[model samples]
Target: MGEVEHVVGMDIGGTKMLAVVFDDQFKPVGRFRKKSKAKVPPEQHINNIIQGALDDAGVQKIRGVGMGSPGPLDPDTGVIIDTPNLGWKDFPLAGIVQDHFGVPAVVDNDVNMGTYGEWCFGEVQDCRNVLGMFPGTGVGGGIIIDGKLYHGASGSAGEVGHMTLEVDGPFCGCGKNGCLEGLASRIAIAKEVVALAARGDAPYILENCGTDLSKIRSGMLSRAIAAGDTQVERVVRHAAFYVGVGVANLINVLSPEAVVLGGGLVEAMEDLYLDEVTRAVNDHAMPFLRKNVRIVPAKLGDDAVAMGAARLIHDKLAS
Candidate 1:
């Protein structure tokens, strides 16, 4: 065998950071992760997190670095154009990392990475076309056509969340009304629980958050369901219904061989919501679309994005 090249894969998000070293076979050799605090500037904070991971792995040289981050980014130029949660705009992430470490770097949207990871090594490995959706702090989507990750014009093609779900529903952080994310995201669910609590129906959430309705989170609703709170179950079902509606629309349009769902919410509550979403898609999607689409849980779990980032670098270099 020829000399092998090691690679570092990093996932950067609003709340946490992770780094992993991968051997030539793409198996993880080592990993590091930590909560991200607010005080650090974007560039320095990312560098520190990556450097910590490098130290933990006890290696200085690598083939290249791959990074997946929350998007609306320019993957071609490796510029994070803007991420509302991360407070980044027009940031040259790949360039800075390459400059600092003297290795090549590639950056892409997290969802894109997730889909690629699944297609390469997870649930969609056998499929030529796949649609991947991640539902957590917000909603994001990615598509693989003919086994290639399609970065549409300006690298903003797979933004399934911004699609309009309701004409005049809740306002999205992107300043749009009735976007899928505005209606079906974790933040949206938390808002609904807070509203219900304000109306005296969220005792569980109130108790969980220490009587502060403002502190209510989606996990509280999940806990309430675990505690047999009928009201929370009802709220969750309603939220799942919207998510189903949105997903059904994607099934109709994309008509991919597989549709994989990921993210914290999906990983934690998939059993609770999967049936509802699947039913909605089967019932509402076009007959041919429904006939061809296979809805399943993503296989990579929390490591999907990071692993996908590593694969992205590998593919880049291999090509």
Candidate 2:
């Protein structure tokens, strides 16, 4: 019997972690998911998830491991420079993973990995240039140029969320005012929805998610939208429009063939969000670029980062 050549891809986010085992062909053989518990050190949770996935897959020999984590991080050195959500600073993530598993490991920004995953295996694989904009707790972005991922000089190039959308906008988590994330992210929308509900304007949100702002989530917003809550629809539309505007700016600057939108909010309210975003792009982008660029939803869903991480390992081994 021959040993199977396998690899592991892990996506580490602010709230959760998912580790997947893949065969040489990049097919998922097994997966494990766990809460990240940001207050706690990440090492134990990461180890448990990877080992659990490997155990479930019944694999012993892994060629490599790739991880997608929040940034700003150094992809080349595999160091997490800083991640506010995860409270990690200057952490040698790749080295720790490699030492723990006795295999080569690579780490990059989570959004970058998701973008790469879509570029390699999702709808935009055929395109030479693409942009991935994901709006979750915060907005994250990734760029693919000339069929390869582009990490700017500091490996933080695709920070679409941090781009200033308004000089006097609300403060963002990144300590910036009027950034796209502050205006368009799910968190931003949730904040608006909660405020409206507190003001007795959004009875549906109040009824479903209660008065606690933290209780309001994307699913609640989706349900409220489906139930004909005008307030939810209005807030979502406003956010989606900003997202589209951001996309339009990217199109004008990068001239990408496609812009992929992903994240919980977009996945939940695809048609409503996409329509508004498309309208914004058409309204704001240069006429020629608008006509040529396609705005699409992400196909890979939660597995996008994992698939991208796997691809990263595969590419490294090949090179």
Candidate 3:
């Protein structure tokens, strides 16, 4: 008799698109997932996923929609300025979604959505200020200040991966050298592991993944570490240390209550990564800042971005 009230949350990544239908209370009612064909226009894929989820949930009334996408985009205007992974430039993602669904739509950086999800529903909910750093194929950062997301003047305040860690370090995906991401990301670590395996230094990796760089995933690396592959452990520890350095700098500047670490690598090698990162932060951070701050792992796993997107729509409607 009454129309089912629902909203949609979408997470758009280079390889996949996930759409979830959420009831008014933020419980997931239905879900749809599809590959993101980078060579094709994103509109159709996005629409298909949302519609599929809605159809599965049998919902007729959608309050709004929210999306988490890769950045260098304008959140204020909900435009995807450029995403190297997807080759989308100057795309009005939110507008397209809104037009298709006939409801309000909001968009923000994927990692920012993850940060918001953690802040609102994950481990950092009680903290007024929190910093989120995720090390995946790349490293991403997000900040919550005074219980609000802080989008800088350019709406890119939390591009912490781009921060220069060395004057002349390895080149980053952003075409810059010495970025934190270049020094310490899953991609960066994988490169080192592959090279070592090629040279016969990491027999475990070579025996498992062969010479294929693409095969050197976080799960594989974690298995190598578990099997006591010293080379893999060293490389991963080094990368985690650099990540800690970046976290230390953020602590010195923002003094957040907690620093949340997430991503595939962190999830797989939680103990190893946490141990190294905790040590590095304590070693490098200012004594005063390190005293009270807690460095923790993200709890939401893969659902963070989607849940955060849903929360964004809810917040917008409430405000």
TM-score of each: 0.93, 0.96, 0.97
Best-performing candidate as measured by lDDT: 3
Where does candidate 3 stray beyond 4 Å?
Answer: 38-40
Question: Which candidate would rank higher by TM-score, 1 or 3?
Answer: 3
Q: Per-residue CA lDDT of candidate 3, range 1-319, in tens?
A: 5764688888988899998999878889998988888454678778888999998888867989989999888988899999988889999999998998789999999999999988888877889999999998899989999988899899978999999999899999889999999999888998999889989988889998887888888899999988878988999999999999999999989999999999888998898888988999898999998888888899988888999998998899889
Of the candidates shown, which would achieve the greatest TM-score relative to the real structure?
A: 3
Residues 1-319 of candidate 1 have per-residue lDDT tens digits of: 4554788888887889888888888888778887766477767777877787778777677888999988888888899998877778999999999998888899998889888888888866889889888877788888898888888877888888888988898999889999888988888878777777777787777667744644655566677888776786887777777777888887777778988887767776788778778878877788877886778888898788889999999889889
- Candidate 3 at residue 215, lDDT? 89
lDDT of 1: 0.82
- The CA root-mean-square deviation of candidate 1, after full C-alpha superposition on the true structure, stands at 2.1
After superposition, the stretches of candidate 2 with alpha carbons farther than 4 Å from their true spots are 38-41
CA RMSD of all predictions: 2.1, 1.5, 1.3
- lDDT by candidate, in order shown: 0.82, 0.89, 0.90
Go through the candidates in order and give the clash count of each. 0, 0, 0
lDDT of 2 by residue, 183-235 (tens): 99888988888889888888888888866777777788889888878987999
| Pairs with backbone N, CA or C atoms under 3 Å apart (clashes), candidate 3 | none
Candidate with more favorable, higher TM-score: 1 or 2? 2
